[model samples]
Structures are given as structure tokens and as C-alpha cells.
Target: MEEWERWERRVQTAAHPVAYRLMRAVAARGPAVRVPRVGVVVSDAGLARQVLTDTEAYTKTGPGAAAALWSPVLGSRVLITLEGAEHAALRRRLGGLFTQGHVAGVCERVLRAPLGGLERRLAAGEEVDLVGVVRDGAAEVIRELVGLPAGGSDFTEAAAVVSSVRLWRRSLTGRQLHRARAALARLSEAAVESYRSGDESTVPGRLRALGLDEAEARGAVGLFLLTGTETLVSFVPRLVALAHDTGRGPDEITDALVEEALRVTSPTPVMLRSAARAGRIGGVRVEAGERVVIVTLLCTGAYGPFSPERDPSETAGLRRLWFGAGPHFCLGMPLAMAETRAVADALRGFPDLAIAGRRPARGVLIPAYARLSLRAAR
Candidate 1:
């Protein structure tokens, strides 16, 4: 395997050692495998897309779906937990929040100082821990999005909640659920205040203006805290590391390269849904109420190894399955891409950027480097 591919494997295995191996083993069995506890695992891009888009047979609100895990903490009204008309309506109202123009402006406002510091440090030949840089920048962006104050344990608490979840589990345990609720409630306090103020400058106020009740606005903040922060924290450093290890330079960091890296890394490696009705996915029978594990990393990995020069046609059918597909497609994609490009652009200033050191995060929900130290090549 290539050096970059090897390191990528290490990151995945470190975060989910048993689950990663089991997923690869399952993928080898076929595009779809129905394991005892894990339900039917779908590894083919087309099949994964089929299940994701077929809302009648599969749903995020079914017994073993994302709603079961997240709705308790984020509330039933949050977009991730709602389905059908409610889901569509919530997405429509929230859609204005994540437009390309608005997301770009948000990223610029929140990331400017941190990204500037990153460029300055690299230019001075100082080694920088990109993981920490990404964490701080992502935290600030999420805080701004949630209308929180300058500082708190927002990211840390949200990560704690996510880390408690396992692949095979349908829902968090009672204690886990309680802890998750408390953490989110703590993080949502400032957002609640902002929502009440109805100032319109902050995101919570904007949600209020968008006709979301206080509960829905609070749930939205919790959703952003959980989804928006860690994915960027997982992806940005890995993108830089992948570029360096693959002998690609700063000039190579384009939107296509970013998309390629996202496919290869698959930050949200697995997506969970439940069969709303008895159905067949990739010719495998799925009983109603069973879980459907979409192994996105494997689905995308089937195309080939990481290569920016690979024809766009190769992944054309996949339609960026990494972000997901259909109505449940990632609502924050613009913000995620904007943040990714901002970081990639910051690093582009250093043509000789090199990975000085790295360590993969262990026992976390997202596969990522615990520390990816970067410096200019002397």
C-alpha cells in the first residue's frame, strides 16, 4: 500500500479497531452482508445510494435508525431525527442558513484569525499541530453558528456524547442518554438566551426569525455541535497529511483534491438507517426494523486508491456518497466545504509543507489524527 493509504488505515483502525476490521471483512463477503447483530451492511456505492434514496423502505426515523440514537438528545424536531413532511419542511426553513454565500461569509468571519496564525507559524518554520488548530477553528465556527459565547467545553462535550455510541448499538444506554442530554443542555444555554433575545445577528436568533420555536432552535444548536464540529476536526489535518504523503504540493490542493480526500477518508465512515419495511438491498433481504449500516469508506474505496487524476467518471455514480444521498443529504455541505477550502488555502501558502510527526486518535467515533505536526521543509 502507499504510505498515505497505510497511515489512513492506521487512523481508521485506531479509532475503531474491531469495527474497521469487521467492516472490511464484511465487504469482502459481498456488497451486502447481514451479520447477526449489525444488521445488513451495505458496501456498494450504488446499493448504498439505493437504500439512502428509497425513503419508503428505509428511513432515519425507524427503530434502529439515526433518530433512535440522536432524537433523545437533540429532540424529535431536529432535522436528523425527522422524516417525510416534517423533515422536508425543517430542511427548507434551515436551508437559508447554509447557502454558499452565507457559509462562505461565516467561514471567513470565524476562520480568519486562526488560519492567519497557521500561515504565520508555518512561514516562520515552526512546527504546528494541525489537529489542535483544526479543533480550535472548528470550535469557533460551531460556537458562532450556535451563538454561544467565546469559550466553553462545547466541542469536548459534544465529542464525549458521540464517543459513547458504538456501531452495533441502536441507542445510547440510560446513563449515556442522561449524560448526553446534560452535556447538550449545558452547551445550549447561551443559544437559548440568544433565541429569546431574537437579535437576528446570531444564528440562534436567525433560527427564531426562521420560525423555529425555542425547542427547535435549541435542538438545531445541539445538532450543529455534534455534526459540524468533529467532522472538520477529523478531515482538515488528514487532507494536508494525505497531500504531503502522496508527494502532492500546495498547488495541488484544489476542490477536486478536497473531494478526492473526502472520498478516501470518509470522515463519517458509517451511516445508520433502519428498514422501514421489508425490502431488498443489493439482493439481500432486509426485514423491517433491522438496521442498515452503510459503510461509506468501503463503498467509495471500491473505486480505487486516492488519486486526484482519476477520472471524474469513476465516482460519478457515487454522487459524493460520502456526504450522503437524497433528501437526507448533508445540509451543512457548503459550510463543510467552505471550511475545508479555507484550511487547505491557508496551508497552500507553504509550498514546502511537510508532516513532521503524527499520531492517530484511538477509541473515538471519527478516525483522525490525534496530532499531525506540520512544518516547512528546510
Candidate 2:
């Protein structure tokens, strides 16, 4: 196979085989195509931006991915289902926590112990399970921010199972759902603890200050804990692989590396938005109540293949699209970046880092490795 074709094949392995076929087919037709995939579909970067940033046209409330799946898990009127001013208000209220400086500092402190342990293990020439390392470290960061009780690895493990539920549920059978719910059931106590009395600096307290009662607050915290940590686990380790491929050493991590990984991984690959009003994305007219699916991965062309030193002009719209464009842009991006940076910094200790091997894709909801094993060059 040619090099580019070979590289594109890896993208397919990141998700279920069928999902990749759909994306490739739609993309070939251009930026936007409508053949009923939950609704109108858009895979072009310029077009995807208009759909996401124009909140008036495409609202997330109607049967889109998050509303469809998460509402079942978190109940109605949760942040993911809100639109317009209400959505803007809640995001604004919590915006302070995600500021660039605040997130960087807080990340270094909360993630220090776990990251240091990982660095030490790699230094001893151990084969590290990058997936497990990212899960434990990312979960601890979210656990602290959301006010979950400390100590046990249950939260991390449970979150790993719970987060992927969003991706594969549409095609999942009763047996799979039941098994996933059983695993997700472990988060209840942590939510209760946080909602009842977690520190004001955390989500539960802030939610309360914004008028959510204990029950509502508890459910919201549960949603974030389940959603937040797993997404981190999926992307951060992949960035390590990208780093090694680009010849980035353990001690070298650039802002460009963080940006490129976010683009390549495109963490929230598909975002579903229902049209609140009529709209045109790349000449395709979308009616009210129709859905617009933003395939961020293909839309960004997998961010034009990871570059160790990407130029700003070349990546003009990357940040807006990858993190999301407007009001509904990911609230957890800063936290996600912080953890990615930490992973990059830790990988610096290993002079030669490479994946130990690849396993056949595990059919995950999100595009991810079933296990990303790693070894240092001897």
C-alpha cells in the first residue's frame, strides 16, 4: 500500500470498521451529505464549523448523540441538553476553572504524584500500559475536580467502562448494555459524596451555587465523572504514539505538539446537533429538527497528519473546531490539554519510546486502542 493509504488505514482501525466506511463515503461526496445518519451529515471542516458555531441554527437538544444517550443516563435539562442563553449561562459560570493559566497550574499539582510514579516506572525500563497509566492519572484529576473520594482505583476503572458507552450503544445489544450498566453502577457513591459536601472549589458546590438542588447536582456530577475521565484516557496515550513517530523526545513538549495531537485525535470526533431553524451547510439546506453530525476527525482531515512543528497559519481553524466552535465547545478541553502535556512531559524520561505492539481494534465507541503497550528503545 502507498504511504498515505497505509496511514488512512490506521484511522479506520480507531473506530468500528463500518463507521470508518460511512465517514469515508460521506467525505468523498464533499463537506456535507444528507442521507439520514441521525439527520443531515457534514464532514467538511469549513462546513462543520458553521454548524457548530451557529447555535441558533443547530441546537444539541433534539435526539442528537449526547441528548439521546446522556439524557437516559443523566436525566433531562442536564447541561448537555440545554440550548441558547441557559447553555451559555452555565458554561460562563464555570468558565473560570478552565482558563489556561489556572488549568496548567492546578494540573501540575493534582497530577504530580501519579505522573511522577509513571515517569519512575518508565525510567526503570518497565513496559508501561499507557492506557492504564492515562486512566489512573486522568481519573484522579477529574476525581479531584468533581469531588469524588480519594484512594481506590474503582473510579478510574468504572469511568473507563462508562465513557465508552457513548460510542457503541447505538449498535449494542441488551447483554452489552446490562454489563455496562453494572460497571457504571459503581459511580453512585462518589456522586453522592460530592453533591452532599464536596469542596466549593469543585463542580458540585459550583452547581449548587447556580441553583441545582442536591438530587439534580448529584446526577450532573455523575454525568461529568463518567464522561470526562474516559475521553482523556482515549486521546492522551495516542499523543504519546504520535510524539514517538514525530521524533519528539521525552524532555521535549511544545505547544505545537499539544495542538497537533488534539487535531489528530480530534477527541470528540462526532458531535450531533439538531437544527433549531433552517440552515445551509456547504450548499446543503437543512430544515428545522433535522440533525447535523460533525465528523471532527475526517472534517479536520485527521488534522492533516501529526506534525511535531506545525505552523500557526496552516492550522488556522484547528483549535475552534477540535475543541468545538462556540457555546457548546467542550468544557473539559483545558483539563484534557493539561493531562496531555503532563503525559508528554513524562514521556521525556524515556529516550526511545514506541508502542510494544498493536491489537486488532476492540470495536470501541470512540476511536481508541484496546490497549496501547509501550517500551523504551534499549
Candidate 3:
């Protein structure tokens, strides 16, 4: 394989924009452009729907490899990997906790936790690695929101260890897999203990009222944090980096710049689905058992046919799908977007912010800066 192809195969999951580009090329060109036997093509939205919505026909279950890799670590039934009524039931069960109002409340807290860290770094007259700052901040918020103990920094480290599994198609081994499972157990137990100790206010009252046994509730900690914290870590800095790289003048009205950045740099790349039943989609014949993916991040923005110029729609409304779509749409989207808006809004006051490194640092995945150091101007 060529170098770029190797990178594309190795690390780029749906989170990586390049994968979307490749898929789009195949879709537009025809099946012949893609590996014929692999059956990955993006040409027909019909084919896309087959993988995304046809839960019954495609059967997200395994004899296939993806499930075997993920089912043990991420519950076989977590929203992303689930199918049929099982997926619907879980979505409904968790609905009350992730309503708009609740998500907004969580965003408020996530936005504040990082202020002290950023301020301290600025006060010391040292350059800040925005990625590290954002990662730590997001990790802290996720643990606290899930009602986990902040006693040790282990939460962040454990989170990093587990997040590594996001690249499971490549480097995952039995040992790392075992660590991820154990970490989930630890985090879940802590969440259950915290809930019992008057920490019900941290999560939704309805969640606590669900009458889950301790272990079941604990198991949910990993699920919640995976969506809530990890997504923020991936997206927020990318937003900041885009704002900085695009040379949006600090005084050019922060809110507008933030909107542009969100539109320009959608961080979540791929949404996955299985055909509910065998049928045709986008004029493509989809076998009932096929898996399909939609690349919302890259395909929805100004680049694709869905350009905002012609669409004249606000990024916010359509941006919800940036989190996910259908019944399994992201539970933490409002919180994530609110936090992103707050972070960008705050940075607008720093008129001196500039790229600490090159403008467009390209990788096989999402556009990221090798170093996003901002010099907070006086």
C-alpha cells in the first residue's frame, strides 16, 4: 500500500475526514473505483441508507469481526453498535437525561473547568498546548458529570487508555483490550457509589430514578463518558485550531467567527448503520447483511452539494446530525456544542492569538495542528 493509503487504513475511522473523501470519490465514480469485493462505495445515498438505517436486514450482530473487537469493551448494545428494538429501547430509556436543557447545564460546567488551567498557563508566560489543556479539561468534566471520584488523576489516564481503543481496527491487542474492560468496570463502580452518596444532583434525577442495580448503573459511566468527553476532546480544539489557522481577526466579532469555525471544522466524520432489511437505496442494490456508513462531517459542509450558501440554513440546527442522527443521535450534542461555543467566545477576547505552528497540518484524519499554541495578548 502507498504511504497515504497505509495511514488511511491504519488510524482513520469515521472520525477522520480523509476516509469520507475516499468514500465520496468512490460513490461519485462508481463501484469499480473501490475494491469490488470489499463492497465499500459511497455513490448512492440508497446504499448509505442500507448501512445506516436497515437494522433488521444488515443485522449488526457478529460472525463479523467489528463486533467481536468492540462488544467486550464497549457494551454490545451501546448506541453505535446496537440494532433493532434493542437500540430503540436504549435510546428511549436514556432520553430524559439528555434533553436540551440538561445538556446546556452540563456545557456550562465543562466551559468553566478549563478557565483556571488556561489562565494559569497564560499567567506563567508560557505557551499552552491547547490540545492537552482541552483534553484534561474535558476529562475532568466527564468524570465529574458521571459522578466519578476525582481523588486520583487516574481518571484521565484511564480515559486515555480507553480512548486508544477508538483505533481498535489497527493496534488493539488482547492486553490493551483487557485494560479497557477493567477501566470501564472501575469507572462504573465509582459512578454507582457516587450516585448513592447524594451525588444524584450531578446526573439527571430521572437517571437515578431508573432503578438500575448498582452494577448496571456503574456500567453506564463508561458509556456516558465515551460520548460526552471524548467527542468534545476531538471537536473543540479542532474548532479553536480552525479559528486560529483561518486568521479570523480577534476583533472580527467572536460569535460569527465561532459559527464559521463550527461550519468549517466539523470534527465527527462518520456515522455508522446496518440495513434493517434488504432493499435498494440511492438506486444501489444493498444486500440485507451489508454494513453502510455516512460521512456527515465532510460531506455536509461547504465542500459537498449540501453547501450552506445554497442551503441558507443555520449550522446549529443541521449541526445536530454532526453529533449523530435518527433515534441514536448523540445524547450529549447540546452540551458539546455549547461548550465549544463558550470556548471560542472566550478566546475572542484574546486579540493576539495566532498560529503557534503552520496553518494546515494535515494528517490521515481530521485536520489538526501539530502545535496549537496561542499567545494570549495583553
Best by TM-score: 1
lDDT of 2 by residue, 98-146 (tens): 7788778768888888778777776777788888788777777766666
- Each candidate structure's TM-score, on Cα atoms with residue i matched to residue i, is 0.97, 0.86, 0.76
Q: On lDDT, who's better, 2 or 3?
A: 2
The lDDT for every candidate, in the order shown, is: 0.89, 0.68, 0.53
Higher lDDT: candidate 1 or 2? 1
Better of 1 and 2 by TM-score: 1
What would the per-residue lDDT of candidate 1 be over residues 1-378, giving only the tens digit for each residue? 889999999999999999999999999999999999889999999899998888888999998889988888998899999888888988898999889998898899999999999888888889999999998898888788778888767558777778768767888999889988898888899889888999998889999999999989999999988888789889988998888899988768988888899999999999999998898888899999999999999999998999998888878888899999999999989989999889888887788888889999989888889999999875
Best by lDDT: 1
What TM-score does structure 3 among the candidates reach? 0.76
Candidate 1 weakest ten by summed lDDT: 151-160
- Compose the digit string of candidate 3's lDDT tens values, residues 1-378: 443223222223334444545665665665313334333344333343434444455544533324545567666656555666766766666666667776667657765757666766665566777766666666666766666666675566555554455321423578867787776766676665656764556552335566544544554566776666556665566556544444554444354554554444455555444444556545566564454545554444533321223333545455444555455556776666666666665565566675454222334234333345666755
Off by over 4 Å in 1: none
In candidate 1, how many Å is residue 100 off?
A: 0.7
Q: What is the model-wide C-alpha lDDT for candidate 3?
A: 0.53
Model 2 vs. true fold: TM: 0.86
